[model samples]
Target: MTLTSKQRAHLRGLSHSLKPTAHVGKDGVTPAVVRSLLETFQQHELVKVRVLENAPDSAKSLAHEIAEKLAGAHVVQTMGRNVTLYRPDPEEPTIALPR
Candidate 1:
């Protein structure tokens, strides 16, 4: 689902205090990384990912690749080597978005 600017901003605020749960290294966006993110999405609608200096691509590109890999995920924010992603659970979403 596409997020409105307000919703994206809300998500960004919520994600500020969160620590990165996944990391992208020189391996880039591997299947293993995608699988880990899928597992993370099961528990939370929003997730933060950190890209190491050795990563193959830029943070924005990696974020998009990550969002593309996950079925309904969206790129919420990308700052420096960090990326915040959002994907509401299909069965029972945890975070509510503003209309």
Candidate 2:
């Protein structure tokens, strides 16, 4: 599902305190990384994923790729070397974005 700009901004703010739950490393968005992301999403509806500098793809590309793979919305917020992503959980949702 696509999130409106307002919803995205709200989610961004909510994810501010959350550290990266999973990191995409040199291997980029590998199956393991995707699996981890999925698991993280299941636990926390909104999560921040860190894209390591060593990753082969840019933060934008990686974020888009992950979003597509998981069929979830993607929010890219960057601070220096880290890129944060927010994707809603399909199963048990712990956080609900503002409507």
Query: What is the lDDT, from 0 to 100, of the residue 28 in candidate 2?
Result: 89
Query: Which lDDT values do the candidates have, in the order given?
Result: 0.95, 0.75
Candidate achieving the largest TM-score: 1
Candidate 2 yields a Cα-based lDDT of: 0.75
Candidate 1 per-residue C-alpha lDDT over 1-99 given as tens digits, one digit per residue, 9 for 90 to 100: 589999999999999999999999999999999999999998889999999999999999999999999999999999999999999888888788999
Q: lDDT (0-100) at residue 2 of candidate 2? A: 70
Q: Which of the numbered candidates is closest to the native, going by highest lDDT?
A: 1
Kindly report the root-mean-square deviation of model 1 from the true structure over all alpha carbons. Answer: 0.7
Q: Taking the candidates one at a time, how many backbone clashes does each contain?
A: 0, 0
> Alpha carbon lDDT of residue 84, candidate 1?
100
